[model samples]
Target: MPAEADPASIDAGAALADRGHGHRNEGLAKLAVGAIGIVFGDIGTSPIYAFRETFAGHHQLTPDGLHIYGVLSLVFWSMMLVVSIKYVTIIMRADNKGEGGSLALLALINRVSGNKRWTAPIVLLGVFATALFYGDSMITPAISVLSAVEGITTVEKDFAPFVLPLAMGILAGLFAIQSRGTEKVGQLFGPIMLVYFVTIAVLGIVHIAADPGILIALNPWYAIQFFLSDGLTAFLALGSVVLAVTGAEALYADMGHFGRNPIRVSWLFFVLPALMLNYLGQGAMILSLTPADAAVAIQNPFFLLAPESLRLPLVILATLATVIASQAVISGAFSVTQQAIQLGFMPRLRITHTSASAAGQIYIPVMNWGLMVMVMVLVLSFQTSSNLAAAYGIAVTGAMLIDTCLLAVVLFNLWKWNRFAAMAMLGIFFAIDFAYFGANLTKVPDGGWFPLMIGLIAFTLLTTWAKGRQLMMARMREAAMPISIFVDSAANSATRVPGTAVFMTSSPDGVPHALLHNLKHNKVLHERVILLTVKIADEPFVEQETRCKLEDLGQGFHRLIIRYGFMQEPDVPEALKRLTGCGPAFKMMDTSFFLARQTLLPSSRPGMAIWREKLFAWMLRNAESAMEFFRLPTNRVVELGSQVEI
Candidate 1:
């Protein structure tokens, strides 16, 4: 067979293989660049404040060699272990159909668990983790921009008075442009961040060349000595040290945007090395100075690395980099909110797709403005990055701790790994997460209370919405008439119209309230009646072939179920067009979309507190219209309103 091989076949096979390899390489390169811009932004901007905060923060320490070496060692190992090993290597592998994040992981866990009794608590943990993410989303922009703008003070002492106003201005501008979309601006992010990382790496290398002793911080012994000698002081420094790895979760959260391999490659090769080098450079610079000079230099170590002539340019670059960082968090908040809405944990918000080619690039106006207001308030209140730093770590640490708990469940229950191995991994992650969380707790009296308060408020809103929705659905079902019963009773008697009526319902098996109201008020039914139910599955994406399922209930009635994953937005009309075996192709002008608008009347319900019910009512009242969220044609839509008490 080998001797008789056809020449044409051999050449074609070789060409195909070469093309495949080339395409793969190109795809990987593109993704790596994109991941560098989006996934690494928050952590990339950390060099602006992380090193300085450790030595000159709320719990300031003398910049002696031991203290400098110890803090650097802690920062280095924290990146290596917490970010590289725990998140990039381990947690990223536990993705749901190539999607990563707390909610995605929770959905995966729920799917695998088959609805066990313990699943409720696991789901709550994930929901709370998602809520805490909002707090992180708010704080990240405030602190990152403030820290970057604070660099101006180092350029010239007279610029100190402009710090807060400049930071607020930058943040306001960043949020202002969010609605117009970021597709254009986002293209430059990868290249800008690439330049930023390389510049920081070069700066670090130049400083490290002068004092090579800073390399000792790579050893574990320095961190050990730090804890052994300083006791409570060393432990407390962790509150600031945690800042170095703040955006590490973005690596996993944004994995769905970029694949695993690209993110891993970017982190190991570029991002990690640049960060460690910069931290070490800052440490080395501090060590070369006398105690008095080091104390002043530590106030803004990152900017001080540049020559006096270049400090102004460095500030400009830092400001741009911080804006990029803030953009990632804002975009992430939009993504997570969309997911929550689909998963039924939050109310629907207006979502605008900015890029037709990219599904992930979306804008939410309400979230954007709300975040901006909160961020500006934080900037004006804190007045400096150091004070804002105290509020940073709590939400991040809480989310990370929840991720560890969810990961343990994934390993032992889903992956079916060895129990001891899973427990061992869990123990290590729990120890680190608990320590960081505990350390940040000490800052509550200063400013840590801010994120904690945000987390609590967010958690309450999320859980209340979920519970209220469930109770409302149960009440609706109790009041619902069966579709079969309706079809049989009314098909022969009701007046038949010429067109199609698509009634949107949450429950597939019941007659929609809008349908009932239509029959009651109009005394007529369409010749072709479609009871449509949109469902969100526990996966990130649903295949097109399986998206719409049509069931013939007979007597001119058809049940259509449109399925979407949590990561997808539902388009009812688009799904309707794909439907087969219906009377004809769905024409927008010929079809009427029917929707039920519920007016919630808070009652003494066993499900939620009365105040929470009122809050749910308020949220329900403000939710985006179904016509808009489902992308239905405006003229073809009809809304039926009814009051429901739970």
Candidate 2:
């Protein structure tokens, strides 16, 4: 009754299906492993300090049964609610063409909102969130590595003096290796983290077996009873409990690097289980000790989970794990900075691609060194991980709050969720975020000001650069001459040369100032004149087919618009090679690229304050040359300077 297919066709269809399944399996495996190394590293390393600091930190808590149970419950719920449900399940879906992070999310929201009055406030929130990330970037490396190295004190009292110097050396070495890139380093991260996670889980299980009653902390009633019984003490404990989810934002930020599925799988299957087991195990271990011994154990329960003989080995493993954690945030900083530059929020800086196969693997010298110096200063200033803990939670909590706000926008405007449902979800997230933020605010006198100060400075710089560029573009457009008018007036009268000339401009319809200056001073035009404009899109990567658009203005004059995503670096030479039907084929040696270099003269402009204007002038003066930023052939490029007052 059924029609039989041809044997060859059936075999081919089965083979094709097999190959498709095989590729999907292989891709998923690779992404999951990679996600372990980078996406989960920060949160993975949190157990080292999160448990220890909750009892012995600046806001010290008594190591009684109620307190221990309550704290463990908070940690569990925080990870489940803030990281698992919110980021992994919800916020990650708000990606901008597969890219995630505050900037990418902002671009997505901005694109969907069109031109609403609320857009500006939303943009400011995103910018401030980005500014706070720099502070987190600097502090994560310092605090994580320091906490790992401090494990030495638990091994032997004599090693106490060596903690600071050893941490500094390890951190210094970590920063030193960044210039060489992370391809080789990244290979070891996944395997090492796997071992670390399994080891911690085993450690937790060993102790949990001794005090099976500790498992009761998994019940939400413990957390509720905690708030009811303890009042203000429990309220303030939220700050220390917040550490359990510090690197949660990295889950969303790194979605583009490894897709949503792998990250979610890795977290749900491996990372989350290991973390909960370890925190629960530490709580169980403390419960088994006598009051005096429990007090001593509370000071460094993470490292003490091991036998005396294995302590040193555990410290070594932890140090490696923390280094991997630091690497994740460092790489994130480079990615975010690149996005900002592409999005026109910052001035151009030197960026080097480390892996030819992976465009996302990059090294930025200025950002790397700047982070290293600040990290070192934090180590010296805080002097201990316990002290640094005071400064940690504020930035993370602030970013989390901002993310919730942005997610509300996406839910209402993009996802078209019911208004009541969206608001209900937002209300839950806001309450938790606000509670944690308020708890951290109490830490300002005890070193929390560090992140706040850094945030303020970064926010000022980011806003100033964005506003300055906007004003400069407006001023340039006022003086810009239409390309049609320029060509009609001078096409025949100007003497012609033999080679090709490419003029880079912000406005596609206008002749570039560099072109006007070149024609005025040299009194000659090239045989093939191309007016080129590079536009950055809201997405991460544009397809090759739609990358370039060409127009023939007649009489050997052409207009070309090349588009790139905010996550990409523009290469003028490579883009030109893809252009067709635009006069002659491009040869690097035969083509000369023309760029305009503006010299800012600060005036009493209505746009920005005098100080900000001066600051913008300094930043503009120090920005990398366009030839280098665009990856143009340096020898075949010409820069024409002009003065602009804004």
Candidate 3:
């Protein structure tokens, strides 16, 4: 040995390490509990409708021992393979700096690959996955809430008429409460869900004890046997079976909120066990009944698992769980919208930070109201959870297939995993994803057309906005004069003014149009002129120390580039407050912010269709103002209008 270790120091170091480990374990346990409430809500609530739909849905399956066992086996294995292995184990590892989602994963791959020939298609796949998620988001709330409320009919038939209105009212209330931050309400989620999980588990265990034989469905052979026996029917049943694993994507998407270990711990140890037990319990109850009773029981097997005295309370508990599940999906929508905006795939909508402590806790009023309206319409149109179930699987399966495609890219390209192992995993994922997607295709005429339509519309809007922004930036860049040239001429020609002026632009290399407009109209240059560009990087967060960058130009001119990660909100005033190396400190009252509002003109351009160009124009016109998005001092801001063609 180079030197003898000090025994006391070694003991001290070991004690410190132990303390750190203890703290880490405690944190993980707390986060895992939180993850159970939020991350697993969607999938957790699936047992409410998933089993019922497989039998009572559009493609009705017989609730006999064979079919029941087969379905149960399929559900269990799907949870194991899709949710546990694919998402919890493999896909969660692909997080972008602890952030997980299609956009984050896409950014990670883009940054690593660096303009490979195949990256363009991968990007499109990721965008389409995001698009599909929107459709899924809309359906999730409608179906989840509707299914739970439908349980009221099982308790009392006269409560049936109130189902639609009651569900609608509950949804409206849920949406209405979103303006207030969820941080306070989020605290209770874990405890309430903990109770719910325990209650459901107890109900499952009671039924499981009645006939421990139901445990046989846990075997994969039963699943394969059903496919072998009833090939086409089994294939079509997958359309409904896929609903069991509907929220698997949410696990990976929400990894940033809760760390990978917490989510994994929650799912593998608590959520998965509880869900499988409940599903198995449902199958057991059906098996214990006669054909006639089983037929009626299958219509509402999950609630029937509880005794007559407790059915109503069971319904209430389930409704609460469904509400929590819907809340999680709604929050996910807001998060996704924020990511899309920062990633430049969407227009900047007004975003309200709801919680002072939790930066990620935000409320998007437009998205909330829009989703509310859409969900109300869906509830009104579909009228029943079974009917709504028909529209559900396509978007989810499509998104899953897209995720598999993305995962394939991650495996082969980014991780450079062993070729054989990667292919084997991908082969299984693609097969399952494609089979589910193909089965859901049969649902198109029944109601699957809705999500496809939504996905198409969302895809068109997203792509149009992205392409239009790119073209607009290019046009602006082409027209802009070099900053060095502008500084050389304007510094001496213009009369110097007293205060600082910050001209906002998309590009760092050129003079901003607002600056040009300010010069022409005001006929003066500020003593301290800052040309500012806010850049969103291909990451989730930029450390504060490296965030602000300043470059000095001659004659009191400076170019400021503030880099923000895709998940971060751009706040110019706050950023400027912390900025150093820029000659003088910025004062809100003394600094004037300049922004250019671009009005797009429809041009016969090769870039996009005229219709898409018009759509892009509408989106641009409706986007949140730069002043608001950048959190500038409103009183000291100037807006200049310019017409541009792409």
Q: Which lDDT tens digits does candidate 1 get at residues 1-646?
A: 0123356744543332222212334577787888899899999999999988888898888899889889999998899889999998899878777678998888878776776888899999999999899999999999999988888888789989998888888888998898888989999999999999999998899899999989988998999999999999999999999999999899888887777778888999999999889988888888899988988899899999999999999999989999999999999999999999999998999999988867888999999999999998899898888899999999999999999989888787766799888888889899999999999999999998998898899899999999999999999999989878889999999999999999999887788999999999999999899999899998887889989889999988999989998988898888888888978888989999999999998897688889999999999999999899999999999999999998
lDDT of 2 by residue, 1-646 (tens): 1223356744543332222212334577777887898889899999999998889998788898999999999999999999999998999777776678999999878766777888899999999999999999999999999999999988888998999999999999988888888898798889999999999999999999999999899998999999999899899899999999999999989887777778889999999999999999999999888999999999999999998999999999999999999999999999999999998888999999988767888999999999999999999999999999999999999999999999988898777899998888899999999999999999989988989899889999999999999999899988888878888988998999998999998887677899999999999999999999999997677778999999988778999999998988898899898788976679999999999999998899689998999999999999999899999998999999999999
* Model 3 misplaced regions, further than 4 Å: 1-26
Q: Of the candidates numbered 1 and 3, which has the greater lDDT value?
A: 3
TM per candidate: 0.95, 0.96, 0.96
The local distance difference test score of model 3 is 0.89
| Full-model lDDT for every candidate | 0.89, 0.90, 0.89
Instruction: Order candidates by lDDT, high to low.
Output: 2, 3, 1
Q: Give the TM-score comparing model 1 with the true structure, all chains together.
A: 0.95
lDDT of 3 by residue, 1-646 (tens): 1124356744543332222212334577788888889988889999999999999988899999889999999999888889899988889888776678898899988877788889898999899999988899999999999999999998999999999999999999999999998899999899889999988899999999999999999999999999999999999999999999999999888888777778888888898889888998899889999999998999988899999899999999999999999999999999999999999999999999998867888999999999999999999999999999999999999998989999998888766799999999899999999999999999999899999998899888888999999999999888989888998999999999899999999888788999999899989999998989999998787879899889889799999999999888998999998887766778999999999999899899779999999999999999998889999988999999899999
Model 3 clash tally? Answer: 0
TM-score of candidate 2 on Cα atoms, chains taken together: 0.96
Candidate 3: Cα lDDT at 396? 92
Deviation (Å) of 384 in candidate 2: 0.1
Show pairs that collide, candidate 2: none
